[model samples]
Target: MSERITLGKTFKPHWVWAIAFGSAIGWGSFVLPVEWMDRAGPMGVIIGLWIGGLILSLVGLSTGFLVKAYPITGGAFTYAYLAFGRKHAFLCGWFLILGYAAIVALNASAFALMIKFLVPDVVKVGLLYRIAGWDVYFVEVLIASAVLVLFAWLNIRGADATAQTQFYFCVLLIAAATGVTAAMSFAPETSFGNLLPLYKPGIPSWSAIAAIVAISPWAYVGFDTVPQAAEEFNFSPAKATFLILAALVVAASHYSIMILATGLAMPWLDLVDLREIWGTGWAVQQVLGTAGLAALAIALCMGIFTGLIGFYISCSRLMFAMGRAKALPAVFCRLHGKHGTPWASIVFVCAICLLAPWFGRSVLLWIVDMSAVGISIAFIYYCAVAYRLFKWTPTQRAPAFCKETAPGKKLIALAGMLCSIGLLGLLLVPGSPAFLETPAWIALGCWVLIGLGFYLTLAREYCNTPKAEMDRLILGHAAA
Candidate 1:
């Protein structure tokens, strides 16, 4: 009976073990610096180990509660569809693809930059060609593009390989980061007090609040990926939620340790410059010397490679689903009969990702923000759907978590939506000063326009026909 289900049961119903871990490291690694700078300061950086450790666990606990209640392959997209009609579902899915793709591109680009940094010889002919009294790396596009391709290929080959590689790399990263921090903290030259905050600052000031708001809640970004593996988990909601919560705790611990070690080892000024923030290779070099750095670089490459593969797999699946719905070219919906993979969609997704890095110098940075904003919007839509399910949907049953007409569930859902909406709104504000030059609103509008156009085209015939004629025609056609 289960074999006849629409979802493939070949793969066990386990939360995406590997993808989740990769996302944790990839998303949390960079976010550590951002969060450390804002919430911890120099002292906050060191103390972030303890404070952030606690905070992330709480967040994981909360998210686990919700995720257990709803487990579906499309993540929040599936939830939105069930509660809200097809229109809301379509937008959420579209935005999610855009967001995840952007993030994958950005991460690839960053990985490339790190590679060049660790091995100066990787790029030949480094000359100071001063353009307006500034030196820029000339081979930016070549390096990043190469990284994207390499990762995409790795992902297309297999999922199991990707998972194993990521698991090992994660272990190494944690080890290397730990070693660096331990040395820094214990070194006679190092003063741990400098890394400690004077006080908690009682209540945060408006300015401080603004900084936190602006910093982006990256700590919470990849939680959406949880639901996408609904069909793959091996447990009930209770068990799945437990696993998710466990992963988050481990992830939080790993990141907090790294941030603390980094703060203790490097000066505040040293850490502030994004360029100075070394990739896994350079970071290892600084702590463990040349040989250590080389080993770390290899590990870093493996990690990045796996990340690319995971992104390709998930995004292609999404695109394939969309294509099947005729939201995209039907060609993308075609699958490899033997391999059982969406080979066409994979190629298309990888090709699109390859092109994104060509958007000039700020490609990586822009990609992250673009993707982040898109994901936030998608989350807001999800929250809206959840609320609707709890409110308007007469047939909707309360999940195990939210059973009664409890005001608390309503508040949580409302808060989640409001928070997501507020961030998305801020991103879209034209006059609002932000990190990027292109207005967020413009980018968002473009995505919306493109998605809506496809949707209207797919539903055009039905939308144009009158209700009486459609009913009569259906009846006549059936009788015939």
Candidate 2:
């Protein structure tokens, strides 16, 4: 195998925690409270989301178990290849790449949305065309594009710098959100009574709760990001699963706090029906006046930036692994000599997201709805690999890390696998509340078609390479 560089060990435990926690929270927790409440009531949203978090805890543990078994980059991609083969790896990477890219774009476009709300006239300059009731504007696009470039550059700079930045951003994000939650508690206009009509009327309380639980896969996605950075951990591999599980708890709490805090600022029913571009922001403004809005702005911006950085790190690292394995053109395998970051992959992700702002807000909502299915597919594959390898396969074939595997780890893997499938059914089934709308279906279809074209082109190249050689490239000389 031709020699290739690897990412260095620079991530501390806290840094990995920040990446997972921050990525999982994102801007969704801050901005989507109103929408989440609309789907499920305020209390229902919190209960269902927490329930989803607990479910995803199982998935995160399964993923972390695999991280220890492999201790390599590429995350689910590497796991898929190990469990199946090259073609499966390509399929996994194809789905994951879109999920990662769409999220980066989703968060980037969200930053623009926040900016538009803060200074409506400021970002409204030079209005462009509109898409699905969302007006596209040059200044808003510029703001979003600029942040995309900035984050891409930071990621390419090095893992050390990027991880440190993520930690501080994560801290500020939590603090900002907590500030609003605390203010809502003391605000004269707020009381427990404001939380009345706990579950949306006409919808069964159980159904409302189950509806949000179904979104657990997407809601808790950032926890899996820990595996993508396992290759760069300065700590022991044994600590990975704990970090992921802990991050999920924090992420779920952060989300719940935001939802409850928003709901308390005003009667949730009144808050839910508002047509304001940002009822969440507007609600916060009402509670603490401008100070509350400022805190929210800080939280939203930090959420966007950290999510952008965390996922870019994951995206570039996944592509780097795939490229090194010859699943992608080797261009992505190249790293900066000084920083040891995947410069090419970062640039590619940044370039794709740069167009997101121009696509308008519809792109943000549609892509997220579409990407959830792709990432859930990833969850299925990862858990399948775990179940097959640790349970059914001969024990001798297991990695050294698996020698002391937990008693019920296999069953947990099975549950994770089934849960992911349920998540898919919830979104794709005809009558489900979480069903993708027409635009999302169309967006998802385009991504699959694009992936198919790329796969056929690369199939010839993948075939020419032997399995042993591909393993060496992807797992390196240390691989058994």
Candidate 3:
């Protein structure tokens, strides 16, 4: 087996937390509340977020345990490799790569969309061909492409630069969110009356709540990024585990606060009819005028930028891990000598981001929804791996987070697996509220087929190798 090229350890403890938090929150904090409330009602969304958080916390515990046991770059892929083997690990990595790449593309499209909202003419300046009912603009595509290149360049500069940028952006995101929440709370327009009816007249409350819960994984998706960079964290394995949980708590709190503030600021019925409700920003503007909106927009733009950066960090690392395993082209595993960064992988992701805007906003959204399904599938595998690890591994070699061999720990893992399975089923089953449209489902199916092709080719090449040699080749000696 060839020696694996490893990523540098440049992410400090705080930076680890920042990446996880920033990635988890994203633009969803600002935009999702309106839709969440629309579907689930104000109180229903809050309760749904809380329930979702609790369920994800169990998944986080499993992830933390695995990170401590094997602090490697692949995150879920590494765990799956150890628990199952090469073929299963490749499948896990393939799905996760799709999930992370889809998010990066989603953020790129969002950056263009947000700019269109703030300055409408830029998107219309130079018209491009339309796609899927939405107009494609040349300038909008240019902006998205430029932003993608800028962030990809930053990542290629090295992990230290990426970590520092993430830390600063996260701080700005938190401060801006706090300021908006405070302003909304004090405004006379903000009233609990807006939250009076917990559900819409015709919609069943249970269905509404279930809808939010079904998409909850999207809200907490980035927490696993911490584990993706485990080998690059400049800290103890235990601290890395703590950082993952801390990021989840921070992200959940941020989502809940934003949703509550948006609800208090305006009546649900008033905003329900509009295609998009500016929500918190509009509420603040009603009281404080243009200045408040300006502040909120700046904060939101910052949030979007941070999200793009966070996901770039994650997807690049995933590609790097897969490349080292020979499941992908080895070019992806090569580091820039001076920068100590995965230049090829970062560039590959940026190229995808650059092309995403041409598909238009509606198509991009479908991709994002499909990505959620991919993430849920990966989570189910993660939970199963955690259960097997805890049940069979010796205490001395088990993750530090798992204090003792107990039935309760095993149960948590089981619950996480079952919950993830239920969520995946909700997304895939026809007629479920969470079921994606035909096109999105088709896109996801095509992506999986491509991954399978890659797996078959790689498996054939390694077929003649001994089992031990194959394990070393696929899992990497560093992880073992």
Give the number of the best model, judged by TM-score.
Answer: 2
Which residue runs does candidate 2 get wrong by more than 4 Å? 392-407, 477-480
Q: What is the lDDT of residue 358 in candidate 2?
A: 82
Model 2 per-residue lDDT tens digits across residues 1-480: 578668888899999999999889887887888888888898899999988887787788888888877788898899888777778888888888888888898888888889889899898999889888888899998988988998998888888888899999999998888988998888888887888899999999988998898777777788888989989998898899999998999998899889878888878888877867888899888878898999889999999988998899999999999988878888998999888899999999999888778888876788888889989989898888787656443554565324344548888889989988888999999988788899999999999899888778787877678767777777664334
lDDT of 2 at 339: 82
**Which has the better lDDT: candidate 1, or candidate 2?**
2
Candidate 1 vs 2: which has more TM-score = 2
Give residue 178's error in model 1 in angstroms: 3.1
Better of 1 and 3 by TM-score: 3
Q: In what order do the candidates fall by lDDT, top score first?
A: 2, 3, 1
Span of 10 residues, lowest total lDDT, candidate 3:
393-402
Top candidate, metric lDDT: 2
lDDT of 3 at 150: 86
Q: What are the per-model C-alpha RMSD values against the true structure?
A: 6.5, 2.0, 2.8
lDDT string, candidate 1, 1-480, tens digits: 001112343333232544555565563354335334544364444343334333333334434444566544555555554455456666778888887776677667666556556565664234435443333444655677777777666655554455456666656655655665576567665465644442225434333333334324343345445565554455665555455555556665655555555554445444454455353334435555676565545545544554565566667766655554444566655666545556777777777777754563344454556666667666676666555434324355654323346455455566667666766665566643233346444566677798778777776643344434432222111111
Error of 1 at 300 (Å): 3.9
lDDT of 2: 0.85
Error of 3 at 227 (Å): 1.2
lDDT score for candidate 3 against the true structure: 0.79
Which runs of model 3 end up more than 4 angstroms from their true locations?
Answer: 277-280, 392-406, 462-465, 473-480
